[model samples]
Target: MTEIELNNEYFEWMCQLVCNERYSRRLSYQKLLRHLHNIDFQYMLPMDGNRAEDGIDLRYRFGYEKEYEGSTIASYLDNSPCSVLEMLIALAFRCEEHIMTDPDIGNRMGQWFWNMIVSLGLGSMSDSRFDAAYTDDVISRFMNRKYKRNGEGGLFTVERCKYDMRTVEIWWQMNWYLDSIL
Candidate 1:
């Protein structure tokens, strides 16, 4: 299949899994595993086999390992250029309230979201320095403090606080641009 087709399939699969009622609880990880099984996606059980615990799993089923080529979820998120934006859009849609309230993960998600835009060659909509500026702006807005320059000649400036909506707008516009393209 084409890359776009593959990405779309994966995206739909993830959306269905997340939206299922049985898989939508706080103890949802097990539900996710069960959903994966229902969809014929193999997964590795946690080495300890204690499904109640919270941590990474090391013992994956052969099918699951082979399908993903041993890449961790984070690595797949970082490298999958074609579907990264859609994945982020899905995540943002699902976690809208949490994103607005939790600055740390939201900022990181914003950065990754913008980075995906850059990787897709959509950087021309804004200045070349947009990503760094956008990240700094996000930090300042969420922390609710002004940034202070560390040194007169340094390229880096330190933010004393979190970020706000204006900072988020920069990244939002980028996402909007991407949606238009897609």
Candidate 2:
């Protein structure tokens, strides 16, 4: 496959791994996939690369099957632009898929995916409403630890948070979120 084709395949795979219809009321699966593709396209890692590594590690830690249509993270990152946001979003999907036990939510993982997007205030940035400036600003804030102590703009926002969600890792923040809703 050509470079563009390969990138498109990889993006579609990642979107499939993360997209869920039940939780996508604000944004459809197709729009979410396109948005993720855009986000990944614009993503540039920091000098240290710790954050990128962390997000990649999280995706792997979730044990997601990455051999999609003959593409892996190595191949995808080898060609396309690098970004943690999409990977982290995928990680959240996997985490909720495996960890959360909320039966009422039906598709728990899908709900968690949208919840995180909504938590970051990205739900309204649909295809028609997508503004790169707003998307970039929110993504930068998220990666740079600019979210509030209680995780106002982060993936998991806890009401009356006991721990500083920005300082806390995503795993623990997810746990906090599960606890909060339970």
Which candidate gets the maximum TM-score versus the true structure? Answer: 2
**Residue 86 CA displacement from its true place in model 1, Å:** 3.7
In candidate 1, clashing pairs total 12
What lDDT score belongs to each candidate, Candidate 1 first? 0.31, 0.62
Tens-digit lDDT track of model 1 for 1-182? 44445434444544443333442333223232222222211113232122211112211222153365444433432242222223333333323433333566443333333333333333332332234444434333322323222211111222231323223322333334334433
Candidate 2 RMSD to the real structure: 4.7
Model 1 scores a C-alpha lDDT of: 0.31
What does the lDDT read for residue 2 in candidate 1?
47
Clashing pairs in 2: none
For each candidate, what TM-score against the reference? 0.21, 0.71
Model 1, runs deviating above 4 Å: 1-5, 22-66, 70-163, 168-182
lDDT of 2 by residue, 15-122 (tens): 655564545454554654565545652222343244345445543433245444334545544443445455565555556666865578554555677677788878
Quantify how close model 1 is to the true structure by its C-alpha RMSD in Å.
16.9
The candidate scoring highest on lDDT is: 2
